[model samples]
Target: MEFIARATAVVGGAVALVRRIGAPGHQAMGPSPQIPEAKAQGIMTLKMPVARGWKEGHVPTCAPGLAVNAFATGLDHPRWIEVLPNGDVLVAESKEQAGPPRTLMDHAAQATMRRAKAIGDSANRVTLLRDANGDGVAEVQEVFVQDQNQPFGMALIGDRFYLGNTDGIVVFDYTPGATSLTGAGRKLVSFKPHGHWTRSLIASPDGTKVYAGVGSLSNIGDMGMEAEEGRAAIWELDVASEKARIFASGLRNAVGMAWEPATGTLWTVVNERDGLGDETPPDYLTSVRDGGFYGWPYSYWGGTVDDRVKQDPALVARAITPDYALGGHTASLGLCWMPAGTLPGFGEGMVIGQHGSWNRSKLSGYKLIFVPFANGAPAGPPRDILTGFLSPDEKLAYGRPVGVVVGADGRSLLMADDVGDVIWRVTGA
Candidate 1:
């Protein structure tokens, strides 16, 4: 096992060096990112950071005119968040479900993730945080729901509270101001579990439908398209009839979804495929149209063919171009719509939690960013909202930001830091 780990690291470093020299491309960020030609690599790069929790009096660096505080801390793998009607905060304390490594590559990958503290047994629970005193910190903490199958998303529509479990959408009777879910939940929609296990969900504007993101089972469908049925797409579920249908297709891994208030359109942040050099494809944020298809497996960024997987000319031709690129392998997982003036000096736009990168030589993300918008569309470059999650030498990570949302007060922003096990609240300094 030690020999395999050392061998993989040596080969990965060499391949990464060669790829970097050959492509030496510009940073693939912003609306128009440079998409280089794909260079296939058999051995995956694994430049992961060693996990290092924050020391005393340490906090992430916030942008000027902003301040950050620990809203809640000492939680277990908090990955997602939802604001309740009565101003309570719901945090999905979960992690990746560990499966036995089947191949040598899988063993190496699992070891890498373990060392980074990125993979672990799922916590399968949700906790509630209440800040009754109006301070930025959460004064009360309690378990809201338990025994879930790796819950990642939560939504409350009318008297129904929807929980996004790995294998299905579960609905429970919700009473306003309730702290704990006591009633049994009924499965609203079923999904295949394991591969890309995050099931992020959002309710429609009118609260009539629920949208869930299902990522592809394998990168570029290496496991065959049959294994990808009803995968790599967003599904819309009808609340009244309990029926569901594919709203959009070919989104590789759409983890965060938000409703754009300006145009009332649904928007999402997608994590694109990997192993295609350092900057061949970029993860993106875009407005999702009903029945629209964004390219995956066959192509990307509006008809630029990946030349990987089996070709589907018809699907590739109709693939929709994303609105903005958030850099390659940034793993931009958390997104929330920000109205104008929510943060002083910042305009209406989106706040993204880039979970950082492990597959690239030099890392990207590991921070929070804001994209400016005008007339309901992205109009300018993105600005940094938070940073300093990595060590000075970039060899260790103190925290990784995941789910981001507007605080219950509607002024501050709440972000989930899985590595640090803390919920950070960002407000004007």
Candidate 2:
């Protein structure tokens, strides 16, 4: 029975690919995206690319007037990045935990990840890179912390260091300019582990609190809504007492977050649920408000009900429409604030590292982008900051950009390329 179901899904996917019938990618972008009705296939549209590492002396193509280089190379699946006050770069090297393939769709998903070089035993460590002389490339590289459970985000407030492991947030005592963490550290707060297990962390500008993004347990509550009790929401933690609460609810997968400077508003890039059609509901970038709800399983894009789930009209009525759409399945992760003069011609904006798509017929994202901001709102269309991560044929991928941050020098941009196993630095030409 499982084999028959799998075979049927494969044939259906092939036929859909041949027809090439889907919404145009550009039509589902920016502030006002053209969202169509739901077109849920029995199985997902899988277009996984084979991972091919960068060739010697070759790198992702930067936008004109910008140059890029491998700041540090040969790391093990680097996924997220953080910079310390002393100009030291910390990278979290990790991978998702593999579970048993229970359903035909799960089997197909596993195969897709295997081909994409995304499934493996995690490195489970955080590494430090330093460019001592202010050159673009790092002269010192060393493992800063190890034996972690898929660590993704790192923050340092005063002398206390916070690490966002998959199951919980761990706090460590640290000394400035130290090379590595020798202490075992204790868990500050616990979170349910496994499903959508990237716990991304950011500290308040005042260094008094921390925010963490936790994703849903399944697509649209397939695992039962009760199982998703504390998932799919951003959490706020008080540094002194370690008390935590949900900051915002109904974000399916809010991986990357940043604070808007002008308004001090918290903003995030959320990856919406899959299995819907190519453009049923676009992934979005939005300002996260306290006690607010953005639709997930019950609805999306402001009360557009997903009929697949049990209807809840009351929750749907309160669903907040996102500020801007980033196109469907773009997997817009790794967000950071970019000040006006940080990268030459670019104005104040947000830098987004899109990890690209696996659940769409045609690929989306696969590059770094910048959304210009004016008066604390998105002012213009997204601009490509780096391109060519995917080959022209779109079958081979050189890299997937994750966790982006302004370099310690405040002029260059640093991005983590997990598939390529390198950290790329971008600066004015």
Candidate 3:
């Protein structure tokens, strides 16, 4: 592992190419999007920012009139977070599991994963943190659940708590204030495992059903479309019947999902295909429709055909265009809606966490941003809320922000920094 990590670093530095298009934000966030032409590369880009641990007294920078503090630290690769009704936060401390490599590309991907500190044994546990006194810090912490597969997303519906594991959805009986769960809950639905393994789960507004986002097994169906069976789409499951069906298709990898409060519509942030330079087929945030196809391997950004994949004119014609573009290769993963008046200057907007780019020469999206909305649609440009994750040279990353949510109190924001192993709380100054 050490040899592969060192080799990837040395080779990546020598072969990586920088972005020709200056900044990614200019092409992002408008109604009529301007997607740049694709620049196809002969070799896969190997630009990964090295992860650096934060200094003891350091934290992320905040926007003016806002303050940032560490809510909890010393976690094991915390990737996603969920807030309980009782002011407790549950964090899924997980790492990706290794699979056998079938080709040279797979070996190269594994080496890159090691260099990025992305591959290892899964911690397979969830930790609970409580901020009893209303301060931004967690006063008490405990292991809420344990001994599971790579868990990513979570949701609580009445007395039942749903956990989205890489291979299936598990459910458990819940008591509000309890610290731990006793047994491995029943499997509600089993999913087919593939390359993209993080299952993002959410419940319906009325709590009658659960929705799980299953990403594609390979980029552009490189592993064959048959392997993508039951993958790369959002699966809607009935809580009572344990029945599941595809609600939407061709999403590629819809990592973050939330229900738009005003219109009661579902929205998601998807990570698009790579190896198409740094600017084409921008990652997007869009309203998800039932039985809708957003175009994955066949097309991108709504009907822009990717020549790499086998052409399917009929499928491309049916692709629904996304509501907003988030920039190419931003890896935009986390999504949450803040109610009106939650924070001053930012009124009723969506907070998205860009996990940063590994395929681009220059990094993008290692920070948290806000997109203001009016009447259930984006109304203005995105604002940077938390930054300083990347160094000025863009070669080192201190942290990568992932799951973000509006705090239970409704006045603060909570973000899970996966690479930093810390959860940060932000409040108005």
Candidate 4:
């Protein structure tokens, strides 16, 4: 139970490039093989693996690196997680679930359904956990904010915790040694609920600005969802003044985000538009330019336009291509930059936790992948770092990985498995 088996296989045959474990001076480059799930099984029954310390790749097997294990089990529908300066983990347990799959072909109509779902009170919650004794495993878990319509994204600033709720944004202050919200949360800002429901949060390195990811109300203009109406955007808010503006636009659904160390670039793992048949428009990872506009509704990848929306000329011309596309419907989320290429070796790596897709006939993405880079961009193709959370037969998924963060121990990583309702500690290889 303490051993980690890292089986990294390519998803396609060898291309022009194989990703390198890179360094600070990378210029970027890429290639691959297709691997089936059976080749990467971490034991058969995947009922949320029983953790016996850090049973990750590398290390001397799964030994206890830290004793304080952060528990997120009671988090109802947690979609994101964060670690504060004091080491407390904030869990954003979103109560919203799409009211069944809407017709992807419908642009405006489906957006309505998404908005309605965000307003549902069933899945909204915010909680905190603490392992005060440096034991690594959490002994205290408590609700910091509750009874909100549906909460998704969160960021901690000084003494306050900012939340991205269904209809708007709010905040609660924190006190060391405490784990729950004490006083009433102060409303910070608001935006009308659109058809889509995604409120992811990230803060600037200096905490001067706060970032929020609000997904488009519709996919690529279906049902007439205009881009200006809050579809696919990264919003920037002034923390000191509380002013807001559209930081970047047309990101489809930027699910997870982090700041890169090499160049301090803002990186995002985005869930691109769906329904282009399987493998049409790849999900992508890219650096967010201050006012950059990513492609949506009208165009994708580079210059590929969706014929489905050709009639709308205005929307078509404004779209911008993505950095590099991920294969269709991967639902990419929860991203972090890894300093090591493999265990004990300081190679360049980007780690992303795919939340898995239900739309594709052949299910995909229920685990983690390593995107090795050469200089500063994706060096080669992606490889599976942590798989087996999804059944090969595509019938069931034991867990849906949401957020990933470098742990208290600099050697390993921590993952939030939302479906299984637990946070897993994974050491390097």
Candidate 5:
């Protein structure tokens, strides 16, 4: 492990000198903008911001007319957030299970994970936070669910609660205001795990079906395409039948998903392929189509072919372009829509939690951003909603924002800060 880590460090340093250049951050965003040509690198770029964490009485910076505070603190690594019907928030305190490296790339990936503070024992639990009396803090906390395998996404339908474990979907009977789950959950379906284990879950508008976003087994099919079956795609499952099928394909890593309020269309924020320089193949947000392919392995950003993979002209031709580009190597993950008139200045649009970059020379996307929407599509450039996750020097990150969701009252935003192990609440000042 030591030898592999040292070798990767040496190779990464060499790769950084030849990093690809492209459009500036702002020019790469919005409905229509420039997408620079991709420049593939032989070795993956390895630039991770060190985790410094926040000091006492400190929190992330909020945009004008807003205030930020810690809602819950001193918890395990909280990655995803789910707001229940009764205004209680459920936080998935999770981390990837550490295992032996299988290859040189695996060693490099593990080193990156350590630098990003992503390597740790899975918490395998969800904690409930109640901010009663509208105090902007979680005064009451309880263990809502426990003993799971790296739980990420969560959804509730009628009396059924669903959790997207790294390897499968589990179902439990839910009751309003319940403090903890005692009954053993039944497995709804199993998934092929190993690579990109975060399975983000969302329910259909009508509550009859559920969607699970399973990421690819390797970057650009490095492990052969056969290992990628049912991966890098969204699986649609019928609640009654326990049947599942791929809803959409070629999404490298759809970590966060939401329903656009205006058109009732499903949308997702995808983490695009890395190692293709700092500015190629921008991570994106788009409205997910029922049977659409968004380009992966064979190509990216619609028909822009990645020369590294074997050519598939037919697949590339059918690939659907994303709605908006977040930025290259931003590692954009969390997605949620705020209703119109919910917050001043920030009207109807989607809020994304950019977990930040580990492979970019200059850091990008450690903050939470709001992308304005008009008629159910991205209308303007994304605006910063929360900032200062990184230090002024940019060498260290105090925290990395992950899952985000509008408060149950619709007047504020709640974000999960995994590096700091806190849930931050952003509200109108």
Candidate 6:
């Protein structure tokens, strides 16, 4: 079947995608009407029973010592952050432009209609927030750099910083004592942004390789790139040489990447293909292996093929399923392998940020969670460490965790909340 046909087949379910982007405010998280196409096929329902036992600590609040900044001061949607040796956090803010359709001056009517009604023109930049004198609170912030082409992800390596966004990647010269990012950055490589709107990034532990993720342009079909040259993939590049290659493919949205110190494996938290309704293909967490594929368009978690996309025979043979599905439509982000350790009330674990759900009627996943690790890797179920980002009744969600970094001290953690524009710190007592 043609991709256009597959796209048409799921047009009814596409409303959920719109709702995901457009639905705003707190009261929207309730038992809601299902999208007919999604519900009829049993795809978009919020079926998971809430785990009542996942109790948060008595301090039902975002931790103190939040250093709000020039980035945090005006950042409407911050997505990722990194810390330099001096203790200042570098923040990435993702802002979107949503409104009436921008006209396309094309003779082809079909092409004109293809342009999005809500077009996004964005910028990505970094800022420095410091808590002077070892105080729990941040005292100063400086605009390190600005004017990035819609940046989203970051990692600090040596004297330079790398950032990934919708358009491509850039390398910044950074030092602990630098007041601001001066001069220009080196352009690593470029990719056309697909519609899922996330570019998660992580550099290897040894500082030799860099991995930048490119999510699918659509939910499940190709934009003529996959069958030709696979686009839904984690791109690995040599930091020094800037030689880039497709590290892994078939993932819908591998929006989170981290290096596990215990095993040295690259782990990714993904936002799988949607439109099966609410629950067909579960979003996932998996160790990303080089040159491997996590099936997308054709197959989903545990070989549940997306019928609409599977209709395209071209995608069937290449479909490779996922490892562990982390539940449906959780919108998983910010994968970080916990530095091996034990802390009060918290088990040894990996940290994953669920940016929160939009497709379902009742909202799910608006917090930071730690997935327990046993010997050295992800071993147990996820435990909620930070709650109340969303309201008690689950109506109003005030924040979304977009990034997590284990501090140099090893026991403390820093969280970047894109929605609320603050860097929350979680300290172990």
Q: Which ten contiguous residues of candidate 1 have the minimum total lDDT?
A: 1-10
lDDT of each residue in 26-144, candidate 4, tens digit only: 21112221111111111111111211222233111122222223343555556777777777777777745445444332322233223222213455677777867855567778877
lDDT of 5 by residue, 377-400 (tens): 998888999999998766678999
Candidate 2 matches the true fold with a TM-score of 0.96
lDDT of 1 by residue, 1-429 (tens): 556656666666666666566664576777778777777777777777778878889999999999999999999989999998889999999888768777877888777677667788878999999999998889999889999999998989998999999898999998888889987899989998877889999999899999999988888898899999999999999999999999999999999999888789999999999888677688899999999999987998888898767799999999999999988899999999999878888989999999998887777889999988888888888899999999976778999999999987778999999999999999999
TM-score versus the correct structure, for each prediction: 0.97, 0.96, 0.96, 0.76, 0.95, 0.77
**Candidate 2: Cα lDDT at 66:** 98
Clashing pairs in 6: 43-276, 43-277, 43-278, 44-277, 44-278, 45-278, 295-320
Order of models, best lDDT first: 2, 1, 5, 3, 6, 4
Q: What does the lDDT come to for candidate 2?
A: 0.89
* Residue 176 displacement (Å), model 2: 0.6
lDDT of each: 0.88, 0.89, 0.86, 0.61, 0.86, 0.62
Task: Locate the minimum summed-lDDT window of 10 residues in model 2.
Answer: 1-10
Runs with alpha carbons beyond 4 Å of true place in candidate 2: 1-16
Q: Runs in model 4 with CA error above 4 Å?
A: 1-74, 98-121, 226-228, 310-318, 341-346
Residue-level lDDT of model 3, residues 292-408, one tens digit each, is 999988999888899999888988999999998888788899999988777777788789999988877666788899988999999988899999998888777889999999898
TM-score of 1: 0.97
TM accuracy, model 6: 0.77
Q: 1 or 4: which has the higher TM-score?
A: 1
